[model samples]
Target: MRGDSWTESYLRSDIMRESVIYQAILEEGELSAKLTSIPRLLVLGLTREQIAQALDLEIEQVPQVIEGQN
Candidate 1:
């Protein structure tokens, strides 16, 4: 997905990852990450809650944004 920037790059970007992490952990997970405030999609100072809010979801319903490298 990361290789082909046109096909799946949009779905596997850092911003997208953050959104997924924020939403998945928020609703499905046990809130173990403790994401409080919102996040910056620019990767400057993004938080768990920020990603969730950006994705139009609750802090407790955000997904887990795993680093593509790791």
Candidate 2:
């Protein structure tokens, strides 16, 4: 049946990894982690430019994330 096959496929790690939704979730988590680390990096004396380069984020995005923290 279609429902059984869908369930089986969903349970497979390879199939789940190939899913668009799964990829989006992974991207979101990665971004969240990067954003969370910004403050710590700043405290450690890294400049916004350095953090942006280190995290592979936009230079503009670093200030925005910094602003959001306050």
User: Clashes in each model (backbone N, CA, C under 3 Å)?
Assistant: 21, 0
Instruction: Give me the displacement of residue 70 in model 2, in angstroms.
Output: 1.4
> Could you give the C-alpha RMSD of every candidate to the true structure, in order shown?
15.5, 4.5
lDDT of each: 0.55, 0.92
lDDT tens digits by residue: candidate 2, 39-64: 99999999999999999999999999
lDDT (10s digit) by residue, model 1, range 1-70 = 5567665666668678899889987775544333332223525666656677665656564443333223
**How many angstroms is residue 8 displaced in model 2 relative to the true structure, after the best TM-score fit?**
12
Prediction 2 global C-alpha lDDT: 0.92
Q: Which candidate should be chosen as best, given TM-score against the real structure? A: 2
Per the 3 Å backbone cut-off, how many clashing residue pairs does candidate 2 have?
A: 0
Clashing pairs in 2: none
Task: Report the lDDT of model 2 for residue 10.
Answer: 71
Distance from true location, Cα of 13 in model 2, Å: 15
By summed lDDT, the worst window of 10 consecutive residues in model 2 runs over: 9-18
